[model samples]
Target: MPLALNTLKRPGPLSKGGMRITALGGLGEVGRNMTVFEHAGKLMIVDCGVLFPEEHQPGIDVILPDFTSIRDRLDDIECIVLTHGHEDHIGGVPYLLKERADIPVIGSELTLAFITAKLKEHRITPTTIQVEAGDRRSVGPFDLEFVAVNHSIPDGLAVAIRTKAGTVLHTGDFKMDQFPLDDRITDLRAFARLGEEGVDLFMTDSTNAEVPGFTISERDLTPAIDKVFTTSPRRIIVSSFASHVHRIQQVLDAAHANGRKVAFVGRSMVRNMGIARDLGYLNIPKGLVVDFRKIQSMPEHKITLVCTGSQGEPMAALARMANGDHQIRVGEGDTVLLASSLIPGNETAIYGIINKLTDLGANIVHKGNAKVHVSGHASAGELVYCYNIVRPKNVMPVHGESKHLHANAELARRTGVPEDRIMVVADGVTVDLVKGRAKVSGKVEAGLVYVDGQTIGAATEDTLAERRLLSGGGVVTVVALLDPKTNQPVEPLEFLTKGFVHDDRTFAGAEAQVNKALKRAKDDKIDDIGALEEIIVDAVSSTLRRTYRREPVVMAVVVDA
Candidate 1:
């Protein structure tokens, strides 16, 4: 969706003591879609979510928005209103709940079911209230109305948060699918009713704004996936996001139609879909689902495996199967259907998975080759449809990168909204709305807090940057004994390199550069431990670049003897 980020127009001021909307995350990026609504000192947080890390964010398992904006004012928060159960929308709930367990969470019944399962992992039992579209809840100064929105995940809502400042409609990731899979189309009637009442500010999802025409409905994927089940005479494995219960529902239906027994492979796929089935969101025939271990006993043509790792996550079930390391056998006469959108930046790994499957003589079915996947987000045509329906005074795009946001703003302008009425901003920047006008007021700390294993907020920006450097160019550690008198190394440096040096010649060459750096440090009479280490790092880096054209992370660990 990143076509361009051309600067548009800035916004003017709102009235005094107006409402402040700050996106702690989900402004400039795809994931971590959290926003704070402040009115008269009371706060309402919408969708505290998380962003999954890419290659650049090394060692980070997940990234949560910095809660510095609300950390000190935890008591000011009323309740967190969730839109859907997708990880990017609901993943950070447990992290937020860890701060204030008393804060109530409201979402659709299926959405709450997913949250409950996620929170159980952290030993947290949240104060949750289930509601459907048309359910109204007054939390402090804000009166919130949850309107159903058709997303990839079922039970998604577009919240109409009303305050004294005005009414703001937040369209959490949505699409205009007239024939939705579950028949729960985005409540356009409710949106039209709210639009008639006058929507002051509209925060819409801009994920697919750059794509022309409307997004294909979830219903569109059924025939394609059913074709895979009907045509394949071997075991069929479908890979997709576990949270896409609608897709899984279709997969189960297809298996039943083809007389195939279903088997869930990934931990999250099993846990989440099981929760979905129990909550009546997903329906399966009696004895339709068999344990993955029991699949061996069944005929290859009678088995259907649904799994996670559609993005080619290394340890995910699909990736493991592609590597032939999985317990489930996928070889000749097997079919692998990639029934999920190929996320940006995951092409290399995804292709690697496809190559492995093809090499193993399995049939590969994907969105590129077949109409097996459709985006959950609205495209340009659909965004225009929403804009025409809910004519707000001011329009701001959220849930995408800078270009996506800018593209959405232009789309709003084409809908007769003036350039000045369109606001395009990034995370941490606050938008103050009052009396049907909006403007950038101030900023907050919306930096990422990376989750590495069980360590949250322990890794800093510099630490991650170093990790990225190490990942690409590798890391070199020089351990030597330093003389306390001169802060000079008294012995030969021990060079330990990882992902850096290839042969003994490279290590031997680096050793000479290290010795020269030590000698220079001693001659300079530098005694400060920190400063001396910096010199070694600089010298070794220069050598690595000059000789090998590598910019590796060089560590100097000179122990005082």
Candidate 2:
């Protein structure tokens, strides 16, 4: 058993006997789950994750939690604790290590393996401490215990952070699955033990707080998988998130049971399953797995293909296959099973992909048609059960939007937790724990840091806004070589437009209007290039908006000779 909260060694009490908890991200949002536990000068960070960009965030690769709070205080950081191996929970490590490479990273064995592979891509090799449930590690003034928690990914853990002042329990993205596929339950006993120690502050995942009843277990998916494999006469193509090893295990087992050879598609699917198999989390029957190179020789009915793109990511394997752009193709008589959850914003893309496959004469099976995917976050009933179990003095929800957080707090209040003890805060709000009493202390400087191609935090919201504008309305570049002495154009105006209707007559009229604006500026004796450029910009913007009902980025350049 892991050491109890108060059993860990404490060197000395801090001058200030309180720990400040700041939510850097994952409050009032779905991803970029991070939090800081700071006591005196020692600080421990948790779950440095990243959020995928939405349609509004054009050209942004990923969204990160702002690092300004810990940039200068990097030396004070004890360590970074990871909860699982999902992209949202571990994607920001490369960005974080760029600033400081020596920071020790701690997580489960498979989690560390995934991180190590990602770090190698960035050419970083840092000190790693591999931990598991019932394991305890001390960092600075904080003693941390990894409590096993069941989630979408294997080896997920909830953290029990013990300090001289109080104990803070953080549930890292969990759902209560009584009979998980792997039989690794959520370790409710540990939570009960922590409750006995008297939890000061409890932060639980609120991703599905509004959802009712308990989430279906992964074991319940076995029957569905068996039916798909048993009935399908053609090739079977399965699409799911690459990190979901347990789901992949069921697919592999079903393929083997049905005498079908398995082939893993998608880069992430292959790599992540390889790590899981090597780390002993995934059990693949030997000789049941085959390479894509030999899949052609095997009969279509004897093949089982596991791939990515369950959320309809454009470049993922299943998406490419659906468009006939990948090596593996899905066609007539084949069954394409999207054995994954449909994320909130991906319904349009996912349905479009399903429609395309159906058009191609393929049978589609998804959550809408069958019992396949189950959520990894606890629902309202499970949340009530957890609140009753941990029995924390204060409850604060994490890893969800405003609605989810509000629902979770209300659930806690109804479950006998004090209404006032529940802190409903957004990103950057800090909750301070002083001598076992928790309250909202103040706010911190926390926001999102966007990651674009080859740059971190360089792509701000303003940059994305300009990108959206150009993408929607297109761009026009107006240029003129002006005679320095005449303060007038020496050449014809140059216009470049994209994503806009290309009509020579329309542009000719707009160009003439712009020249008229420039001529008016010259009559006013506007010798300054900046002033003259502004006149051309206003004229062109007004012309385009009036004619085309669009506002484009107008660039006017007056090159003086």
Candidate 3:
């Protein structure tokens, strides 16, 4: 008898150019994660994310991928499928929808709910389609299957994308846990069945590639949290990701174990808890959890607050608490636990909150000092285990930095997968899958889009140069009142300096020098007005640079008649 064909079906048009995949983001580093798959003339985006701006970025909010390459070809975008509801995976939707709003969005019910909330926040009503585990949907020419996978959050899934080329399984961030709080584990049976049927290309998570062993179960954190609630002498306040349902459950369990009522803070956190409870995904013991507003009415010893703003994003509930602007303040004898790992590029912001909390006489507990946080990523050994499970012809690491991807590739090599078979990809680099083998065909136009003030624009080398200048030097503005009749000065020439001075003191001698330089330029009075303006501005800039040893962007404003 012939063996059963237990593989995901490959619906075709994939061979039109074969199967090609590209990283829109989540390649060189984590955050701002987007991946594009091109099969049979159609493009499918896996996730869209936003990268947090660095410290040097004065007023920038988030960075997203420049979709100029595919924006024109958006008609080919069959559907956008989400793996989970993490910000790095879902945050870019508002930006993406702002540009292209008609595309269909497919994800689990919970994932769709989160996306719905995001759209409502942006006042956009997008067309969203909800799917479930083991369900198959057709987006353009591709047949996609959603396989349940466990992660820090519930409803995480691995997508089995089947095209004319072959079966490509993209595992969004996942780990194997037999005892998940939700009792849902990675569909190993499905994966093994796919392995038996043959997996064409495997794009897997590499965030925890360097660490060995499987990730600890979410249930395991309960005991440690139990210790905190039962042992601590002060009022307990826990801050974690709003979407971490398991952690929320653990916090509630620990609170109940310690005989305390729980109050959830942060609007997003509160809404998510209510949704999870309503959806039956999370159940906090009845009569044990109360609204935050009611917490103030209860005794501090009987209350525990689960909150948001773990990353210290401005205006989050925790930041408000740190500033004492929230309804509940963390005064003396309070203990705050940062129960989530710090996402990268947010250390300064997180530490700022930590400092404020500490200054308010609140005991701050972090990763090591307190048993608060554990990573959601699969470490090195776990990577190896997954590789061993779904032995594939080609391996591509996604969702981590270059260092992490390279490390995972090395682990793959140790597991006897040829180093040549491992491909480390960056944004816009395309890998063509031909006959179940993979190789980089060429590059696509991909770049970062920066959000400055209320305007959105691309982050080019010139923009980066300007950012560097702003960081290293200061800015100066030169304003002059000119006669309407002659396009000549009617008032004294003056320069204003900012971001390069003491708050209370200005260099009197420097101001005099600037005045003298402007007067010299005016005396020269070149016949050409444009030439004269350039000369005067140059003089002021040059004098300030020599005097203050700093270069300020000189803005020349001439009052002309």
Query: Each model's TM-score, in the order given?
Result: 0.92, 0.93, 0.88
Clashes of 2: 0
TM-score of 1: 0.92
Clashing residue pairs in candidate 3 (N, C-alpha, C atoms within 3 angstroms): 211-380, 484-561
The true-versus-predicted C-alpha distance at residue 222 of model 2, in Å, is 1.3
Flag the better candidate by lDDT, 2 or 3.
Answer: 2
Q: Quote the positional error of residue 87 for candidate 1 in Å.
A: 0.9
- Residue lDDT tens for model 2, 319-378: 888798987877899999898887666678788899989988899999888888888899
In TM-score terms, candidate 3 sits at 0.88
Q: Report the alpha-carbon TM-score of model 2 versus the true structure.
A: 0.93
Answer with 2 or 3, whichever has the higher TM-score. Answer: 2
**Candidate 1 local lDDT, 1-561, one digit each (tens):** 122223323323435669989898998888998999888888898998888877677777889988987799999998899999999889999999999997999899988998999999999999998888988988898998989899999899999998889999999999989899889888889888988999999999999999999888777778888899889988898998989988888888999988999999888999998998888888988999989898879888898899998987888898898887988768998999998886666788899999999999999999899998899999999899889988989988999988899899989999988788888887887788877788776666778899999999999989988888878888888786887776556776677888985676665666676667766766887667787777777877787788889898889886888
- What lDDT, from 0 to 1, does candidate 2 have? 0.86
Please report how far candidate 1 places residue 273 from its true position, in Å.
1.5
